[model samples]
Target: MLEPRLRTMWLANAASGAAAVAVRTPRPVFADRTRTPRETVVASDLELVTVTDHSAVLTWTTRARNRAGRLRPVPADTEVRITSADSRGAPRTWFFEGLRTPYHYAEIRGLEPGRSYRFEAYSDGRRAVPARTLVTRRSGTPESTGVFTTATPPPGRLIRTIALANDLHYGEPASGLFAGLFEGVRHGTDEYPEFMLHALLEDLRLPDRAADHLVVAGDLTDSGTAEQALGVRAQLDDWGELGRDYFVCRGNHDVRPPDETDHWGNVFHPRDRLLEYFAGGLRIIGLDTTRVRGAGGTLAPAQLAQLGELLRGEPERPTLIFGHHPVTRHAAVSNPGGPGFVLDRANAAALHRLYASAPGVFLHHSGHTHRNRRSRPDSGIGVEFLEVGAVKEYPGGYTLIRIYEGGYMVNFWKTRSESARRWSTRTRSQYLGLHPDHALGSCADRNHVVLRDFSGLSG
Candidate 1:
């Protein structure tokens, strides 16, 4: 009964409806869903610490929430990838399954010795930030390539020597206040630890020839807190493994007061807390100078006696002495009567006289007023008193001493990364405005020196 045109249109509409029902009934696009990428990701507590010959450890934390609601760990289905390359540009890749934790840690191993490696962390096929690590060479020999260059084997009996210096405060929070007191200046950047560590590792990873041993002079930590001490220890551990044998001496900042102890007792003491970790072939005389009230550093009567006996009794091997405080005039950063910065004058004189008489003492290293200088005592006993710059401060760098058959080379480098340099310039200007006199002494000397080819001891 319907019109022919109406019938035709109704039939067309029914056919279209049928097609729509067929499409929506089985494979509906709206039924299943895909998630959009997160708007914000917060990464924090990033640390590259606990380095070794074949391994390096990394730790970081992610915020509890993302824009949507909460941040969940990368699922087990997700893959975490790590890639590394040595200074020579050789690359290596490692893969791991993602872990579920606000705090994530990863240890990358199977690395070459004495090699510097750049690394990147990745999750879900997206790269995270980049970091760096170094592997130590095998004991008793230096790496032929990569981090170190070829060295001429000793013609005769070779005596291995390592340089020791300590107490360079690189990124001291109060650096601005003490800027004039310590001539060298640098800023406290967010990347302070990284920049300082890089400068030190570069020196330790120098090519040409690796050191037989390395010793930290003392006061590596600014404060006695576990966190500060741990930060310093991480760097030294990396260098130790890199340089073969590494040694440590205790400083005041390395000591923990008794009040801080819990049921387990004091966290760090002169011998047990600080020195025991890195004691190797390098003979370290851990002197407790922190006990002396209002004194730069002093060896207890018993300690001095013990040191004297050790110096006299030990074999003809080279010896290096490290303490937090300096013992003599040139070694002290501040003069006498000026806050008692160096060793008491009387004690310094006595120690110098003893050292002059002792042939076993090859080098004396110290760090308090963070600066770098070399002093030869009036005794003319050939012992070198080397003052190292701070790892945390401006002109921020470390002293790299290379010992060869006839003589040794001393090099000063700056921890002047793009970020660190900018901070240092600002800090130095501010400090110079405050205490100009504090900038006096060898610390003002910005040049790096190389003392080569003086025949005496072997190593």
Candidate 2:
């Protein structure tokens, strides 16, 4: 059986008298693909990516049309003016005029906590916004109440941080695919997987809040081809050692068919390997959540049995588990809940029992729905069931989990590179412009603090 996207195309071909012909869609090597430079600049796709206590990343894309009248992003200076009403009825303003680039990632800092801000943007100093695309649940206009707010910082002496990301879909032609129903959207940045992944790695290395480790929950590739797997590893290598500083779990896309030459397993760990890392008393576990060519996820009986044993041995260790499925869907999360989008219900119940037995597993991270969500399900209400957005699509980036002796903070951070921002903004066309409702979860979902006693772990 073929994937939904491939099956759709296959049926179409079969109907056209090529029933025996098999279609295999492939993308160029991730490192080999590059973006075409744009010559002109027209600002569009402005959005408030996410807001934090003292900082916010405001992004917009600058585009130019070719002789063929095709619109593509081009480099341009990023300029913005944010203002808030003061107590005296005057406007308090903050400004950021930044690097010239097609993907305008403007970082706004020094914002007063809990303050509302409204802003306008420019490409090359031209008031080019009222961008054609609007972030969901917000007005398109610059001055509307759709503006975002800066919230108070989570309190704790930040001990350490982990960067969480997934669904890179390397070597894929496009995203947002539905079986014979909708066409996928190509990335604005041609080599999108590299573009977005690189942005995420660079952001992780930033000085003020650098991540101590990185965990890709799953879906590191589009096709389980060796080239895609190695390509993803090379990108991860640029940040840290393969099995040390960064770790990856298998996603369904990384499962190669048995008859195919794509040996994804040779490059990545198997589902039962149960990769575990401990740093300063904090235990992080990466689970191989996928089965070959299967969209829904399950823990093989052996894998679940192994995890149960590990939790039983040190059930009180401060721990985090990262996998590829949403576990079990409940109303606390988004609407993409279905059998295919998560682990099997019975398997999830078994995992819930393991969580119940292990009091130290405070968080579980998973991805596949290409959205950002955090839920506390009934089965394991004490555990944080978080679904981070795809690193290769709209709202592309990672979630930072900062541990403190008293508690931990989970904050989503969108990649801040020019090409990455441009591509992420363009991919918002998903779900007929309703993607934000699914992908850009509420600010609370994107950023929040969980108070727990982690005094046993050093930050």
Candidate 3:
């Protein structure tokens, strides 16, 4: 039997195979009806999403003719069988039943590296035309391939390079639903969140400059569903070891009403608690500022006390603070007023005062606003409040951080996947047709350099 960790990794890597495939022109398949040939099933747009050392994930659409003469997803029963192209082993099959949609997803694990495989689909036991072939990548290969590879694992002595991503909104079913409300944005993409995240992991895994540590600032989920949060954790696991190389926090979207329940009738509850970790000679803190009501947030008295203790524990330690909401209102006329732009301005001011007094605190990162904005406390606090754009929508990318003994530099990198970029462009209609470029403001919003004496930090 496979080890439990490896098994979980395999399952997580394959959970949303549907997102990896694109919808292609349907291919017609014949069926026998009363000794007469009739068009029955149509399947197309098969795509090989990610290929690991021992597994591959594929997705496509399978449609069947309806009484109205329309091609709809197969209902009652549908099945997919994936076998080694060379017939080197028994085929792995996936079975689906009950009312269904045109989308189909499947994963094949335990395959050798640098190998090839074939797959076919069936609707009620009838094979649906031509089979597709997939070629897995060789171990250690980094560039793109027909079957893409997973992100490379973190390397040794990894404190130098860190990556930051925020506002993922993982479970948001649609965008611009709050149109004419706060932001008056009315654009959203139909792409699955899992697919966007998968592409991000791959983009971050470039061979020459992979991040050693990745921190997701907040809004890991849109609906606070434990399942969605768990899915986010799984994708993060596929990128790096959790709790060691990665950390996360909570955002307003990750909080639901007291009596809220998911589609399955399960009551909504917070997924992640206050998170704190130490790595690479820095104290990384993830604050849960979500409140019970309203779009704004507040830090509980207990959390504030904890923050005070943490800061006082090592006043000289280099520290980084991250959360969902910003501590100060953005310096833009297009930006909203207090509590709307920053729900907890009072506490934010308090924290800034504390940070200004504590020279150790240098960076505060957040992502509530879907656009990029940067500010420092007007009171002359040295901390840099950097807000990143949403990962699942426009300005789709992450901030890459490189630390040195002297100073640090940050660069914003687009997800680099053609599919992700296209989706981002499609969502530019958000915020009342606000151009997508607004999410990615001038260069200053995405890039920065901090020159300070970090000799106090011991890596």
Please report the candidate that would top TM-score against the real structure. 2
Clashes of each: 11, 3, 1
| Local accuracy of candidate 1 as per-residue lDDT tens digits, 1-459 | 333432332344344334433442222111111444343344432333223334444444344354578654332111123323324432333424233333344444444434455554433334343211111122211111212211222233334545455654423455544425654433334446455555555444543224556666666555556666656656666666522466656665555555563211132244423232222343545455554234356666666766666667763445567776766676554442343676666767777777766665666677666655565574667667766666655445555554545444444444323333334333433444432223212321322222333244533
Q: What lDDT tens digits, residue by residue, belong to model 3 across residues 186-224?
A: 234434466667767876665424787788877777777
- After TM-score superposition, the amount by which residue 412's alpha carbon in candidate 1 deviates from its true location, in angstroms, is 2.1
Selected candidate, larger TM-score, 1 vs 2: 2
What's each prediction's TM-score? 0.53, 0.80, 0.61
Look at candidate 2 and give me any clashing residue pairs.
75-102, 76-101, 159-459
Candidate number of the best lDDT: 2
Write down the lDDT that model 2 would get. Answer: 0.72
Instruction: Give RMSD (Å) of candidate 3 vs. truth.
Output: 13.8
By lDDT, highest first, what's the ranking? 2, 3, 1
Candidate scoring better on TM-score of 1 and 3: 3
TM-score of 3: 0.61
Tally clashing residue pairs in candidate 1: 11
Query: lDDT by residue for model 2 over 1-459, one digit each (tens)?
Result: 223422332233233222112221111111111434336567766666667666666666778888898987676655555555333332222333333567766665656677776666666655545344333335533223536667655555778888889999888877788766668787544578877787788777666457999989888988888888889888888789877788888888888886776556777775456888887888888887777666878788878888998999999998999998888556224455466668877888888888998999999999988888876675735898899999998888899888887788777878765566657777777768778777877667887777898876785
